[model samples]
Target: MFCNQCEQTAKGIGCEKVGVCGKNEGVASLQDLLTHALQGLAIVAVAARKVGIVDPAVDHFTAEATFACLTNVDFDPARFETWIRKTVELRDSLRARAEGAGATISNDTPALSYRPAADLAGLEAQGVALNFIPSLDENEDLRSLKQITLYGLRGLAAYTDHAAILGQESDEVYAFLQQALADLTRNDLGLDELVALVLKCGEVNLKAMELLDAGNTGTYGHPVPTPVPLGHKAGKAILVSGHDLRDLQLLLEQTKDKGIFVYTHGEMLPCHAYPELKKHPHFYGHYGTAWQNQQKEFAEFPGAILFTTNCIQKPRESYQDNVFTTGLVGWPGLTHIGEDKDFTPVIERALALPGFPNDEDKGEVLTGFARNTVLGVADKVIEGVKSGAIKHFFLVGGCDGAKPGRNYYTEFVEQVPQDCIVLTLACGKFRFFDKKLGDIGGIPRLLDVGQCNDAYSAIQIAVALAGAFDCGVNDLPLSLILSWYEQKAVIILLTLLHLGIKDIRLGPTLPAFITPNVLNVLVDNFAIKPISATPQEDLQAILA
Candidate 1:
């Protein structure tokens, strides 16, 4: 297995045996095979589109299958086998229709005619033999760019799936996904073409995120400023983690009067600010920090846990029985809730367990400063900036990881000037999320802008602020200090680049997949920089 698509790739190169995320060689190879199959499906799907044969099911499956390959989303090799078979099934179906319509299908690559092995063991062997990552391109530089596009699409697929779940769908987004996947299977594309496709991945991801923002806010209502308890309520409880709101809502409804108090965990923390969700009296406060800390945190929680999306750790035996997974998230033995959205198993498990024995007030933290809430107070923010009370804005947020350098975000947020406003999103905010940064002219100095899934909210906030100041987003006295762990962050960075945003500082370590030549292109065109030796050093340069 050769996997290097994440921030913490083993030894900062590639995970050649077991993945640092606990993905075994079998699962890693299966994921690669699934991705390879998707490329074949994409090639056929793109041809089908030429013949006006677009199937929504094919489009949705393409997104879900690609998303399933994302880091930490699914660890069960069985699930990968299922996805691989389904991808081939869809590809064959599309190929038949397209050929019937006189559209020629490409069989130039083995993926075009590939078939999965009859069993999991055989399939794993097939995947290892056909592994495409190392052999993608003879040119290391072009291979690096392909890696970027591939991972960016993984992130894009995730967002697209999230939006589709909430009844937001776009053909354009689906079309781009197919075309990009097909383009990836080509060998003639040069560096510039690949770079443009990478940027386009970012641009389409913005649309996906916007659709998700609409689905979330339209369904749950715009998040309002709400203070959520870090404390636990004494009773039966179910902790929901990951980034799916619909899963949380379904669980909340099923456990409504059943004495199970639902608590948000990880990225689900922002769900508490949504009006429809917050109205549940049994819905309790947040528990734990980011996804990286789940092993320690989930072990201590007394009740059942439901993981709605990604950010899953290999479950330790102690609490493995207490955990359940739903949607596209999968673990080998965890009870998976199906499309029916039923929470009976989770509810029964919560009932069987002893929840928090006593109430503990760990104080509270404020959230719900998404675009709507922030823009609602646009006048106040504008006035504060004009009066120099809010001298600058620092957007210091992205995916957080367990690496040593992550302390940079916490320390960086600490060093942010008192007069400046700090807007953060995703799990990275956990570093200084609970810090009391006070307020400037009635505006909270530290604003929690929802989850990484709510990145559209953050982008909208920046755009609105830019409009208010009559400047481009890059000119709005804002410095983006972002830390990425997985594919979602990759696509979000691409979106920022797509907008021609410049001078951004990214770190904890740049992606292992980014070749120096490609990094130079980013640096020359966008002035992108690695995080400084110290947050203080970066701060001095930015404030200069």
Candidate 2:
């Protein structure tokens, strides 16, 4: 199995045997097969759409299928097998309809004609040949650019899927996703065409994120400044992780009077800020820190656990039986909730377990400082800047990983001066989120901007600050120190690049797919820089 689609890829090259994230060879190969199958579906979807035949089901399925293949998202080969067959069936259905309308799809394309392996062995054989590294385009630059585009689409699918489930759908986003996927197989495309597609992916992913933000804020009112308890509450408690607000809401609704307490974990920590969701008394407290620490965190948690999306680690035996997965997330033996959204299985396990025997009150941290919350106080922020009270603004946010170097973020945040405000989003904030970074006057030094998708909120805040100051964003005292763990981070980075954001610091390690030439292109064009070895050095460099 050859895979290196994440920041934690083995030695920053490729995971040739077992995935560093604990994905076995079988699971890795199946993910590759699933990725290949989605490419096929995209070819069919793009062709059919041209003849005025747009299947929202096909578009939805394509987005969801691609999402299922994201890093650390789905690891069940059995699930991949089922999804692979479904993809082929969807592609064929679309192809036949298009053919009836005289839009001929040739069987000559290998991607469209792929048959699912009858069993796991056959799946491996099919996938072994479909490894992504081989350059179909002789030009190395074009090939690297193609891969970068595909990675962004994978991220786009994740956001699109979330928005879709919440009853928010964008045909334009879906169309661009399909077309982008199909471009991977197009050998006729030139370098300029591929680069444009990558940027367009950024443009559309921004739209997809906007749709999700709207769906989230519209369904559950815009997040307000609310203090979330970091302590564990007494009673039967369940920890809901990942970034799905809809799942958390449904679980909270069902568990409402059942005496079950639902605590947010990882990316779900920000859910506490929503007025509609937080109104529930049982929706209490946040458990654990970021996604990378889940192995230890999930085990220590007394109650059941529910994963609503990506960044799921292989469950430890101690807590394996107590864990459940829903949405696009999956693991081998975990209980999975379907579209019915009935979490009775998860609820039953929570009740049957021995929850926190004694209340452990750790402390509290304030979140939900989303765009609306920040923009409402734009005048104050503008004043803080003008008066020289808030010296600098650091956006230290993204997904966290298990590597030891991840300590850089914690140490870096530890070193940030008290006068500087820190804006954070996603799970990366877990590094120093609990630390009491004192406020400058009434404004808290550390600001939580909802989930990773809420990077949209962070961007809005930055743009708003620049607008109020009557200067470009770069002219403002702002710096972005981002850490990426999965595909969603990839698209977010691309979106920043597309917007011409410069001099951002990205670490724990760069993507392996980015060859030296590609890295040079980024450095030359975007002025992107890697984090220094010492947090002190990196922090000093950023503030300098």
Candidate 3:
């Protein structure tokens, strides 16, 4: 099994023997098969749509299936095998029904087929390969475009799946995913068509993200500025990691008054900003930094750790027993919290563990100052700008990973002028969030705009500012210096490009899959540049 779909892939190459994310050979193969089957199902769905047959279930199935194959989503081979068999059965049943109906469907139409009632074991044992892998097109440029489009769809599917689980649905985004997946499997498409599809993926992904943002902000009040504690308090504690705020909410609710202190980890660090979530007294603080530091950080921890989503590294034996997975994230031996989202087992484990008798004093870290909170202080911010006290705005954010080049974020944030404001989002800000950058005027130098998805807020603020200044977004005095580590970043980058935003800086290494020609198109069209020289030089370049 060879997989290199994430930043921590072995030695910056494909992971052959075992996944760097703790996905063993069996799990990796199962995820590959799951992805392949989803593509096949997508083919069937697209065909059916041509005949005016649309199955909402099929759209959801494809979305969830694709999401399950994301980097750190699933790692239980047994559960994944079940998912693959179900997907194959679903696809075959749908195909048979379509043929039976003589659907006369167009190649790209969406369709749904029902499955015959049978045990999935037989289907699993057949070892049928879902023939959805796109052949390497002779035109390298076209192949690169297809890769970009496919990866973008993967990112969209992941976000859509999360929103769907929260009872939110966007028919348009679902249709786009089905259409794009089918197109990727088609060898007949040319470069121009693939390029168009790539941009379309961007446009639809923006919708998917907007849907998620609405789901989050509508459910929990808009996030506000709140400082989070970094030190561990004495007594029983549990660390809630990953990006799912709904799960975090449930955990915070259940653990209340249970003598178990709750802490955020990794991407969940920004959850503290939401007014509804922050009001919880037990919602203590963040633990450690990004996902890469987990193996070392979790080793001596005295309580259970709950992972709700991606970026789970291979665990060390010392803490493996204490780690629990919920939602899509899974591992071979880790205890899993299923659909009910019941976290009792994790809470019980936390109680049983010998938690720290004395508080570990790591001090407090600032976070939770998302868009709403910032807007609340708009008057002060505008006044500072008017007074010429705040000279510039820097959007320095994106994903964080184990790669060496990631330190560029640390240096870049450190080099920002004291008079400028640094707006950040996602785990990328973990590098500088702990650094006391102080404040310019009344605003903190480093403002975390929530999680990576909160990049939407940053975008909104930029566009609004541009409107206020009576200029285009690119003409604003704002600069976007991004660091990408996953497909979500890919979608966000495409969204920025689609908006005609130019002269952005991206770094900590470019994607391995991007061809030189495709890179040239990006550079030429958007003036996207890789990070170079010291932070001082890069900051000067952006300021200039």
> Can you write out model 3's per-residue Cα lDDT over 241-260, one digit (the tens) per residue?
88898999999899989988
Candidate 2's residue-wise lDDT over 1-544, tens digit each?
Answer: 7777889888888889899888888887777777778888888888888898999889888899889878888888888888888999998898999878778787766888888878878987777777655634677788788878888888999999999988889899999988888778888888678777878898998899999999999999999999988887778989998889999989988998998889988888899999889999898899888887888888888899999999899999989999999998999988999989999999999999989876777889999999999888887888898898999999999989887688899998899988799999998998989988888878899999979999999888888888888888888899999999888999999999888889999999888888788888889888998888988897777677
Provide the RMSD of all predictions against the true structure, rounded to 1 decimal. 0.8, 1.4, 3.2
TM-scores for all candidates: the values are: 0.99, 0.97, 0.92
In model 3, the worst 10-residue window by lDDT is 109-118
* TM accuracy, model 3: 0.92
Over 309-340, each residue of candidate 1 has an lDDT whose tens digit, in order, gives 99999999999999999999999989999999
On lDDT, the stronger of 1 and 2 is 1
Question: In model 1, which range of ten residues has the least summed lDDT?
Answer: 130-139
Candidate 3 ranges beyond 4 A from true positions = 10-13, 96-102, 105-136
Name the better of 1 and 3 by TM-score.
1
Candidate 3 whole-model C-alpha lDDT, 0 to 1 = 0.78
Best by lDDT: 1
